[model samples]
Target: MNTELPALILGGLAAGFAIFSIGLAAVIGPKRFNRAKLEPYECGIEPTPHAVGGGPGTAAGQRFPVKYYLTAMLFIIFDIEIVFLYPWAVHFDALGVFGLAAMALFVLNVSVAYAYEWRRGGLSWD
Candidate 1:
């Protein structure tokens, strides 16, 4: 009759199902293999070389721009901030002024990082 027992049972069932599915796939899936199938793929499309890292005459494989990394980092920073904010917002009433002050500081810290990134041209695109 315990609420937590059902949750634990469900979690165990989910984990067991995942393991069973993986094993089933390995047994029932295609056994054939080749160089083409083993090679890395992106959206099933052949990758093209770019002029980012390699020079005009030099060759490149999956070369990416610096902006891509900067953008991904920025996304992660904001995403984590939102995750933290959601929990705090759900219990905002219980947290009171202390929670408000804590969140304000957290937001200010994130804002400073954002401003720093903005000033460093992390938001700029070529």
Candidate 2:
């Protein structure tokens, strides 16, 4: 009667199902090949050739700018802030001043990061 038995069983079933589905698809799926289908897609933008030694008929690839990852990380940071805020709000009465102080500190830290990003132009798309 291990407490973890149910979780382990559920995990095994999910993994088995995933593997079975993939195998089934490979066995029964139609094999279709075309130039357009083979080419890599980049958010509707035409793929560019590699920066070095990439010419005609070579594999096309491009390095995304650091700004793209930075923007994504910023979004995640703010989104996580909201996740923490919602639970704190729900338990505001029970937590009293301690929760209020903790949330204020958390908000201050997040705001500082936001202000820094804004000042450094990390928030700008261009």
Candidate 3:
């Protein structure tokens, strides 16, 4: 328990600071509200009222491209995989042949998925 004292103190400090910051924000932030400020923002554009006729301008159809989301998700997945690989690489000698083979298989799997996505136009800009 003595060994954990520093960790406990650090965690408690972090939690206390978080609560303090949130309380400060709540107390000091602006209270003025209006229709414009409350409306849903579109990047930097002002919110537009939906037209009477159902068309491409509808709220649902006005959504941004899905390609951006796919790209971001793929980046996050591969980035996390690389993070795991770095630790394994540093201990490669201790891990030996089995570790090397396992890492190789993992890399191969990642490569196959990347290639498949690439071939299927997942990364295409148009």
Clashes of 1: 0
User: What are the runs in model 1 whose C-alpha is more than 4 Å off?
Assistant: 5-64
Q: Sort by TM-score, best first: what order? A: 2, 3, 1
lDDT of 1 at 54: 78
- Model 2 bad stretches (over 4 Å): 1-40, 51-63
Tell me the tens digit of each residue's lDDT in model 1 across 22-121. 9999999999999988888654345675545676677664555456666888899788887899989899999999999999999999899889988998
TM-score of each: 0.53, 0.56, 0.55
Better of 1 and 2 by TM-score: 2
Which of the two, 2 or 3, has more TM-score? 2
Worst 10 residues of 3 by lDDT: 45-54
lDDT tens digits by residue: candidate 3, 1-126: 999999999999999999999999999999999988887865454344654334765554344446767888988988887788998879999999999999999999999988998999888877
The lDDT values for all models are 0.84, 0.83, 0.82
- Candidate 1 weakest lDDT stretch, 10 residues: 43-52
Position 87, candidate 2: lDDT:
88
